[model samples]
Target: MRPIVVTTMLSLDGVMDSPGGGEHPRAGWTFKEVPFEEAAYEIKGREQEEAGSMLLGRVSHDEFAPVWPTMPEFEQYNAMPKYVVSSTLEGSEWNNTHVLRSLDDVAALKDSDEPGSIIVHGSATLAQGLATAGLVDRYHLLVFPLLLGTGKRLFSTDTPTGGITGLSVLESETYANGVQKLVLDVVR
Candidate 1:
């Protein structure tokens, strides 16, 4: 079985929206607070190397598909198998992309004989749903120092009370730019 890892860039207040420039009011906040660090890229590259596939929600897929394909840095990512969990999307124009209609499809993907990790990036809704359903095996969070008080957060009050999940910190590292990287395993 392959591990489903959810990776995200979050703010101190838990906001994960628009870590890069986008439509959010607090968009580009991460760039403002976190300086460019070669270590960050090295860490991300390592993760990418371990991943066999990439899973994304509709919004995230839409946001990434157009730009990532054109970038040299994302050449490997663009080449990997991409799965988008979206009931509405009938087909995908992106190369090596597949559409999964439901959570059951996601579960099946995890159970499949895939060779390496199935990594998710910037899929806030998908990540939360996976976490709530206890489908997420690990969480790779790069927590930025700044707080955007009013934006979409990683964890919200809407999470089910009885379904609280525990996480074991597998690794933690603080960068020179005050960005903290936490690798957590879901304590299921």
Candidate 2:
């Protein structure tokens, strides 16, 4: 089975929303000021290429579809197959994108002829659902500097992560600006 990775930009306080720009409360900790000199963009791009498809939440898809389609540099991403997990969204305006209602869509992806790793980006809600269904294979966390004491967090609640264990740190790179790129795998 292809690897499933969760790629998210997290603040020091583990908050993942509005770090750079979003409608959510940014708490004056927007990430544009934090220079990511660690080749973060390059790394993410490489990973995206290897991804068989991208899984996203409705909110993220709504926010991303408009801007990502216009950026020529992100053409590859725009062309890639995308799976948007949403119960409300009926159709997608973007290319090579599909709207999924249940976890069965993701299950189909795992059994289909699709190749390469499947990366889930900026979908905390979908991530939670995938986590519950045991869909995620690994987590690629990019921990940035600066913390938002009170904001939208990835792991907002104090719930057990399905007894996650056998955590072996894979790769770590500290940026010149103090951000840390960490790759972790689940040994199962």
Q: lDDT: which candidate is best? A: 1
lDDT (tens digit, per residue) of candidate 1 on 72-145: 98878899999999989987888899999998899999999987899999877888888777788888898889
| Candidate that would win on TM-score | 1
What is the TM-score of candidate 2? 0.89
Q: Which residue pairs of candidate 2 clash? A: 19-31
Each candidate: what lDDT?
A: 0.86, 0.77
TM-score of each: 0.95, 0.89
Show pairs that collide, candidate 1. Answer: none
Report the C-alpha lDDT of model 2 over 1-188, residue by residue, as the tens digit. 66778888788778787755776566335346586474765568778678878889998899888888998877777888988988999888999999888888788787787788888888777777777676777888878887667656666375545455565789888887877888888665
